[model samples]
Target: MTIADKGPRTRPFEANWLARIGWLLLALYVVYAGAQLGFSWQRFSDGLGQGGKFIARMFPPNFTRWELLMSGIVESLQIAVLSTVVGIVISLPVGLLAARNLMPAWVTWPARGFIALCRSFHPIIVAILFVKAVGFGALAGILALIIASIGFISKLFAEAIEEISLKQVEAVRATGAGFTHILIMGVQPQVLPRFIGFAAYQLDSNLRNSTMVGIVGGGGIGATLFTAYQRFDYDFVLAMLIVIVAMIMVAEIVTGWARKVFQ
Candidate 1:
């Protein structure tokens, strides 16, 4: 074996064979999926005209139905606040129970399982179920979003707790502080900021979900939007959509302020 005969030991721009093969497979799958989904350049081009007409119809949004809009908006706000408060309250204990470091295996297992169950269905699906069970209304929407908030916030809260520095907790324990005292004095402080941030984020998410839950008879602006859509009153639909957007924007602002306050 002469050095020259070894072909400089390696080639420049060496390829990752596994990566290349993976990319090739992904490209093939994307093409297959696109074809199956009826995605085509011509179809997209043709849709643009319809989209323009729809946008035109949406302009000069009819807000003559101000009372209807206000009522739905108020209901959505109520649902968002009630769900968020309930979810935050429930999540605090559930998150503490789910913390692997702070809790026993028996405790964490059930807590984690409950959170998973809450997350198993989308809010809309849950709302539908609630409607089916309760015969439709804002109460159904409130319950659906509370479950969603618990699932999302509890998971995040547990993860945040796990990520917290344990040195403070250990120091408190060394002082013979009881478990409850340690959790109160040590653990809560470390996690409170993150907890608040999570709560605020969940509240914002619930606001958006509250709007949609109404479509499934959960009650809110979504019902109005759906009705307008069914009636082909796109101007009214536009009005509903604008209100929803404004509501969401206000929530975002509030949560943003809250997140900053906590952090």
Candidate 2:
């Protein structure tokens, strides 16, 4: 019953030397990048002073042009709702086709490729292109947001479908169900709740992007905000920011409630 009688003790924890080295390298690179980008305490302090002055100018938000503000807000809301509806409808088939578990390789590959193409560009870049193509209006904004929604929701929906329980799917197939019927009874039930959540989240995103697309002449509050900036109307800018924040908060609440109801 001496020490020699005991089996070799296992170490409670072991250091991962490779991971430690990798993290050290990452930290060093961050410092090097910061220096290259001219990030310094002195520069940051000077920025704070300029930012303070800018904030001072934005005091007493001007809602004097309520008509313009109301119009821009309405347009942004329209863009968000329309884009969400169109995008979700399109994502249904594209996402189902892209799910490797559900569709053949021929179908999934092309569907995934299309999704990747949609996601390749930022929404702002897409909006700018649409603006150029369509010549400055809500149509450009709606199209751009729709593309963004398709990219996001479809990818997530495909992933959700892939993760569903195959047991239910097999059971449906055993019942002599065809592909369409199997999807309706087996696949749809499993993924519909998640799909609803994704749709709600995409609506929130579209709302934010709708405001921004107008900066590129896609037509929304962003156009008005950009005009105010150009005219040094900081008060109006503040007012617009307040409204945008309020809109986002409301959307968050609505989406959260929808998620609960569906779940």
Candidate 3:
């Protein structure tokens, strides 16, 4: 067992010439991008001064439109909740069918395709399409978020199901259980917690998206905020932003509590 007989000890990783060249190229690109974008310390300093004046004008936010704000908030909540419920209900079956171990290829392929289609676009893009098809309002927002939620949760849920312990599933099948019975007894128990987690996450996401969809005339606080911006009502815009932040914080807290309790 001499040093030379240790079978050529592996050398520690060191930066190679190629790695050094890559770093140099990255630095050069950053400098070029900064120049192309007109980035300058003097311009940044001037912009800070302009920002200070803008902030001064936005002080003492106007709550005179509290009624309008409340209405918008309620509509957003409804859209988020409705979308979550519908998405969760639909995703359950789709996810189950997409799990390759549980379903035949014919069933899984179509289910996967549907999930892919649902998730192909951003929620805002989907909302725009729905707004065009269904006319503008909460309905369009709800449909758009529902599609987004289904695409997200269903894909993750199917993967979770696929990764579950097949031994338990096989045991259930060995007891002369039907396919549905095996799913209920074995598969559902293993994946239920993960499913709940995905649902909670989707709810949180939908709440955030509900506010955004309104910018495209899908009824919510975003529409009001956009209008305020157009009218140069920076004070009202700031107020709306504060309310949105508070709402999102509350939602996060509630969802955390639900996850803990359920777990």
Residue range 1-263, candidate 1, lDDT tens digits: 77888765686788899999999999999999999999999999999989999999988899999999999999999999999999999998998899998899999999999999999999999999999888888999999999999999999999999998899999999999998999898899999998888888898899999989989999988899888899989999988888889889988998999889888
Indicate whether candidate 1 or candidate 2 has the larger TM-score: 1
Quote model 2's TM-score. Answer: 0.91
Q: What value does the lDDT take at residue 74 in candidate 1?
A: 93
Report the CA-based lDDT of candidate 3 relative to the real structure. Answer: 0.93
Per-residue lDDT value at 216 in model 2: 90
Q: Report the C-alpha lDDT of model 2 over 123-178, residue by residue, as the tens digit.
A: 99999999889889999999999999999999999999999999999999999999
lDDT of each: 0.92, 0.95, 0.93
- What's the ranking of the predictions by TM-score, best on top? 1, 2, 3
* Model 2 local distance difference test score: 0.95
What TM-score would every model get versus the actual structure? 0.91, 0.91, 0.90
Q: How many residue pairs clash in each candidate?
A: 0, 0, 0
Residue 247's lDDT in candidate 2: 92
lDDT of 2 at 240: 93
Task: In candidate 1, list every pair of residues with a backbone clash.
Answer: none
